[model samples]
Target chain A: MASVYIPTPLRKFTNNTAKVEIQASNVDEVLSNLVSQFPDMKKHLYTSDGKIPSFINIFVDDEDIRNLQEGATDLSDRSVVSIVPAIAGGVDFSKEELARYNRHIIIPEFGMEAQRKLKASKVLVIGSGGLGSPMLLYLAAAGIGTIGIVDFDVVDDSNLQRQVLYGVKEVGTPKVESAKKRLTELNPHITIKTYNEMFTSANALDIVKEYDIVADGTDNFQTRYLVNDACVLLGKPNVYASIFQFEGQVSVFNYLDENGERGPNYRDLYAYPPPPGLVPSCAEGGVLGVLPGIIGSIQALEVIKVASGVGDVLSGRFFTFDALTFQTRTLNFRKNPNNPISGEKPTITGLIDYEEFCGLKAEKQVKEITADELHQWMIEGRDFQLIDVREPYEYDIVNIGAELIPLSDLPYETDKISKDKKVVVHCKMGGRSKKGIMELEAKFGFDNLYNLKGGVIEYVSNYDPEASIY
Target chain B: MPVSNVSPDCKEVRFEIASRDFLVAERLAEKDNLELTGIYHTHLIDSAYPSETDRMSAFPNFSYLIISLPNLRFSEMRFWRLNSNNQFEEEVFEILN
Candidate 1:
């Protein structure tokens, strides 16, 4: 008796069995016994001519039957007969391409067909910041044929930690240019097209039209909504992933299923963006260094799957990760009836001014004083309360005689702030202090607050350049 | 749920062959001075075909029997045996008066 070992993908026809024994003395008889036992498998195991396809190799105890006596190869008692099928091949991947992506190609779930599709697809990435930074690196490494990067801002020294795509040398350079250079160094086969401009309504449609898919990594709400609407209008799939502090979210929108029925868009999930400053930006909230590495990599994976036509994508569903608790959840969603772009009775025909749409139109300018003015105030010995709204950790690093009242503790401890005195509130770079001052004006009605223009950094830079920042 | 699931018009039904139940049955068979032979289950909306799920739960050498009650068609009862190589083969059985 010879034991035939059946591989997966064919197990459904074998009654979900892994091994089947046959009372056969030769390879030919063993196959006959197999098909007789599992009649449904005969169609899959053989060609239309009743002959085994060349892709299926029959082996008798580590020896192929073709290398032995062909089908007449005698099988010893208890011999293990294995039937192996070609998982991926047939000019589906080029010689060099296969060598580079051999590990990815071997996965039966993401085989050569998907690899070929990946090599033929183009994806546009918006804002190569935190989410875009890591996502672009993986996409370029994964062999996406062409990638378009759209960003008008230059790189800053602060982006080096989590934005793994940029190095210390790339600071003060255009993000799109640095990103393209770094990506090409990783894989030269794929083309990297850089659009050194804002992905606004003007160029959004034109740039998005060139790519089959768009990856939304923009940090601001206006651009996030802009990218979502543009992809919807262009009939392109948008892969959105955002990280805030220790938490991150990923979703696929405007994606078409097999039947051409489009999935939900961003508006379906949230018809309107949260009022400005309701959700603190990554710049203000601060993120764990490794959080984007995990979230953005998943974003990269989704783009590969969505573009290459493999794996179940995150369409019509939202996936979230909480690094603090190390928990992940996927919430399934559907199209909304009020989605302005894809829903019933569409209102937005094309891209409009997203600033007004996000309620950032009525900009409120807080009172401010520059570092030079503050120095003159110190020279004249101005009597004012210098309140440092930054955290104690930052205050401990460097402080010039300002009482530390961290913004987090301000809501509960607002009584400590003097309303009678002239208040000069300041933060590390004035953003947080501005927010603290706004909270004071809104809730406490203390209109005596004035934000330091460049905050402590500028004050330190103007007087003492040797004052090192922690 | 039997109360209200009817999209397919097939009247859905779920089945489970718990391990604890099997263990209790094995002990009962041992106490009765009988050998544990096989197991059986009813398929309310299916035929007497050996499903992959059914075959996977059976012992390699034990017999399996399915009693199907497909309401529209006549009820059927068939016997099966899981061979040494884990493959299933039908075994003949007859009802007697």
Candidate 2:
């Protein structure tokens, strides 16, 4: 006798009973006995052709019947037969899709079936920047059914170095919009969903819930943590990739294996975010233009592998690429015993303010004014010393008539700063200016200091568009 | 129509029941000249609310009844309707003795 576990939706057929013990030697006999006891459930479980609907899945114990012999799967006397209905999306390839995926169709492992799976899978990309450019392009080209892009940044001339998705003509266009347009041109068979907004905790879960997989190409730790947590909660695989300078890393996080066990998640590798300012962004720390191209392409490959269920994914393994040294390494990692999610129940069930978690949203320690405000103050002849905390090379590229005193030399150059008058600090972006102010106030005890918001780029964009500096 | 047991699958969400039992119930209802009113299911762990999977599989015109069995013991039951926005909205119902 095998015990057939009735799913919640089918329990009514068994007089609201949760489980029914029936005499059966195999899956077919078990299902037959169940139907003999309750007939109406037959239509929902099997079609008129006496075949199980595509939406229905039967599992003998922990293994799916499809993985075994559908109805002829031998069942033990104590085997628990579970009948489950399929979730939302299923593969249905059109004629054009079949033609478009003909190359994949002939492959031994990735045939028409895998191509159909690819067409059914939905992937969400967290950024449309350097890594995102190649990721979105390759994903769309591979015939992924749906692709969602989250980006709030506009195309900048500086992005032309590595972000191949956008050209100089799109310098001021929104990244998501430009990415959609470019990806559409690449593969019109796929659907491209654009989210021209920041990926924040408030919208991460809502947006991530609709996708089957999340590809993290974000350049910041805050968004990376947010994507990782959201994927873990939703039980979605997160194909993650990060590139800095000439180095890149790729891994698949929070993936469930055939044994019903989850692989090591992002928290396993990084228990906590690095301290703010310790890791400079690509904007502050320049990267090789081709670094993201290599990393993001690998991310796309991982996404396809996970989606099509073709090759062994990078789950539980960390892969690194060093373009400078031309060396690659793959390291294996197990589920951390101390991980919060390693237990039966996860401690972190929802997304948190990642910026705050990463310590990027520290309390304001310095007064700041926007570029427009500074421009007005300058026009009014405000007596303030404009100090540029950026490096000398950056100063040579662009300057707003502010005296250069690089952040590294700020301690020694305290006397160069005005002590009597109000002092204004500006850097490439506003980050270094805030740091400069804090250092100046801590060491030199300068009380009257205001950091220019949006830094030099903002000022150049708004006040002086002719400035040929990034 | 009513749904009874929900078995967890390693991959994908699936719902199942015996078709013979449901057909017999439908025939009995037809003999009584009673139209099929709704479908019912049980929730063993979570609240007696329709999940996202339920919303996706819901029939808009039919009532969705969810019985709560917190620890495999009968608890409470609620009726839901599929609203226009494709969300499940609980409906007020009276249980006759």
Candidate 3:
């Protein structure tokens, strides 16, 4: 006798019995017997053509009958049968989008279903700079239903080197405006929303709530942290990429997988931001022209994978590419136990001023002497300990006869300086020198230390133009 | 037979018998000195087939009977049983007048 398990929706036909046993040799006989006992159920199970409906799936002995000989599959005396209906997620695609995404629709893994999911998704891209240029272009081309661009800067002539979204004609135009015009022209099927304002903590949540995923292409720690925190709070996946002179990094953060487990977030990779001005911005450090294109395209790929539900995403993993060495590496990372978002309760509830959070804001009041004032002091033969906190190579390039004490060795070489003499410190610019004065004042308790405002670069430009600029 | 109550865990598109209801049914079957051979429920709109949630929460070693009520009125019913791997299979039954 073959046994069958009835689902909740079909129990009414069997006198409220959940199961029954009957004599049957195959799936066809079992279904035939089912219809014989409850004739009305036949209409619901089969189409007018007498064929089984696509939504109705029959399993024989835990295996889908479709994988077997289907209705003709022979069943043993002890075989069990189950009638299961396919579950459908509500995603629809118009004929136009289907035609537009025909290439994606034809792929086996990413067919019409995945293309529908892509058209149902919304993605937010932060910045219209180097990385955002390519990221937004590809996402739009791939038929992301809605794309939000956050940028406040106008297209500059220097940005044309890597920000490929704009040309010489767009030099003075705002980036979001130019990006919207270009992306709309690329795919008029998608909706492009531009935020012509800075992505700040005050509006991060409001903007992020409307998007399904966020792609961080901004070039600063403040905006990066703000975006990350907002996404983490809103439970959105953050596709992150950053480009430096010759290297780039890409990762997906705060993504919740199918199993209801969250992957590592940005904070897990970088526990905290680097000290302000410690890592120079792209403007200060420089970047290869084509690096953002490569990294940002990868970011777009990850976003598409996430939206379409095709291919494995880069969740909990970090990828690095060095264009100079032509090397690539992928490293796996786990959620940090100490990370605020890891434990049962997260610590970060709302956004804060990221500039102050990353220590970019000046906290202490320090005395400063400008280049002209320092020049006057030098000419008047001022008795003071002039210390140069810039690197030896930079000092070699040009110097104002100040004593050389690189910032890295300042702590160890503190004994060489006289605590009684008035001290002035300088770096390439005023940033590092200000740091040096702060360290001297806090660590060594040097009360007379003063920061040489505008450092050697400013001094040379103002005091002596003949000095070669490094 | 009438459905006494809908499962508290029932969603708009999915349904499940509450654990407490299952316990009560088991207790009643035990008190009546009857072997708990099968369970049954009703569907108001969908076809007479198990949903994914039903498969996930199905009990092994028992028959499952489902009643389909297309318009809040009894229409049809069928019986099923679970196999060794927990997948359901339909079983034949008859009512003798």
Candidate 4:
């Protein structure tokens, strides 16, 4: 009896036995036996023409049968024939597809061998939204061998204006599922693995381990910092692209530079999260429809360059495009003296909590109130002390009738605020309030504090129509 | 049949090893001139195993040093002396940890 190991996705066909033992000799016989035993397995494993589906790869023992006579590769009694459906995530390309990219193939810099490297490489794209759409498309078209898409979001109707991967029909489907279907149709030869889960700290390392490079198309600061940390920790090259309104920046960081030295990662560039409300997301700031597309395609080019080992990768250098002026500037950023990785030969071998490091995660609760809830509190005439911890200028501009103390002067102002009364601290966004809460609790020994989740911006948008928050 | 690829004089002088690596076993064999018999570069990447590119480029029948760069510094150094079947089996080294 030959043991056939079915992957998790194909378990439904095998009656949920991840491992199914069947009577056979040789690889062909083993598969045929499985098909004969479970006819449903055949449909998933093969096409109507009797060829193995491009999505699945057959391995006899630990060796890839493709290198060992493929499906006809021999199998012995008790041999393990593992049927692994190539995870459909990003982009897949083949050597034969080199002709399709002949213009790139002929460039003395990037030849067939370079293209072959691109075809054999695995890349993980971090988003499936505006930036991710074009990034995935170009990478697929260029024929990256294995592409993984890590996105937990589903397609939204509002996303259609910018996200190119999802169509009108895929409006309500999971982003990864729609991306997988569309990308496979775009380049039938590539293997794509879709993870419909968030790239959290727990799974970030494992998910990132399989790929040589990561393309970050994410928008939020939490995801950006998380991706940077994971890539640096895994020693994987990260091609980073960010879009805000009409401005776009693209760079490759945490990769081995020309001198075999790793350059500054995002942490080195921005030590901590920008004072929460200082940066507005694309959702709030509103991005130009084509901004991400332009930046993302360049990100794809950088990924291809990194994977193929051709041309100078954009490590330590950033290229910015101003859509308003139609001008591009390449800013050569050197490694900062204060960078943790500078002067020391450092390697990130494990995943760390980037959200915690950036103070974005809710590790400690400060005086917090949701915008809607805070509005409700206002309407009810609550007697709690609403201390606005944002800057004085911010308070001078417009505030919800709270006393302005500012985060920096909180130490001196802590003496005035009575510990007997509940101090409900608030910042423009929730991040500063979290820090402020920790400070007040640690110093003044204040037992009562709260952080306004989503902060004043959410407050004004949801409640006050005349107030300007940004 | 494979013959020796190291020379005698090369064995007397200590070969250049990075400060992060450890000294294991050394031999004197010959291909033409005095060539050091068993020497391999430390593994800069993880996985504690040789890469496909490594197999295609380096010595196949000699003792190789496998060092892991764990702390961004060289972590473990294991010596592997190849057997007659061209398979690398780890050889014990007496170096202090």
* TM agreement with the true structure for every prediction: 0.49, 0.51, 0.51, 0.50
Per-residue lDDT for A1-470 in model 1, tens only?
98887654466677766578899999889888899988977966788988877546687776777779978999889798877543211133334665788777667677655776788899999989888888998999899999999999899988887998888899999999999999999998899999999888888898999999999988889998899999988899999999989999999999998889898989998989998889988899999989989998999999998988887889989999999998999999999887888889899889989988889888577899888988889989988888898888888888878988898988887888888878888999989999888888898898998999989999988986877675
Select the stronger candidate by TM-score from 3 and 4.
3
lDDT of 2 at B31: 75
Q: Comparing 1 and 2 by lDDT, which wins?
A: 2
Model 2 lDDT tens row, A1-470: 99886655566678867579999999989887788889978877778888888767787777778789989999888798877644331114444655677677667577655776788899999998999988888899889999999999999999999999999989999999989999989888999998999999898889999999999999889988888888888899999999889899999999877778788899899868999999998988989999999999999999999999888999999999999889999999877666665445557767777888889785767988889899999999988889899988889999999998888899998888888998889999899889889888887898989989889999999978889776
Clashes of 4: 23
Which of 1 and 2 is the better model by TM-score? Answer: 2
Name the weakest run of 10 consecutive residues (lDDT summed) in model 2 chain A: A86-95
RMSD values for the candidates in order, in angstroms, are 25.1, 20.4, 18.4, 19.7
Question: How well docked is model 2, in DockQ terms?
Answer: 0.03
Query: Residue B63 lDDT in model 2?
Result: 77
Ranked by TM-score from best down, the candidates are 3, 2, 4, 1
In candidate 2, what fraction of native interface contacts survive?
Answer: 0.01
How good is the docking of model 3, as DockQ? 0.03
True contacts kept of each: 0.00, 0.01, 0.00, 0.00
Which residue pairs in candidate 1 collide? none
| Cα misplacement distance, residue A15 of candidate 4 (Å) | 55
lDDT tens readout by residue for model 3, A1-470: 78876554455567777567867898888888888887866865778998887656777766788789998999888787866543221114434554677687667577655776777799999998999999998999999999999999999999989999999999999999999999999998889999999999888999999999999999999888888889988999999999899999999999988898888888888868998889888999999989999999999999999898788999999999999899999999988877765545667778888999899887887889899999999899989989998888898999999999999899999997778878888888889888887888899988888888888999999978999997
Better of 1 and 2 by DockQ: 2
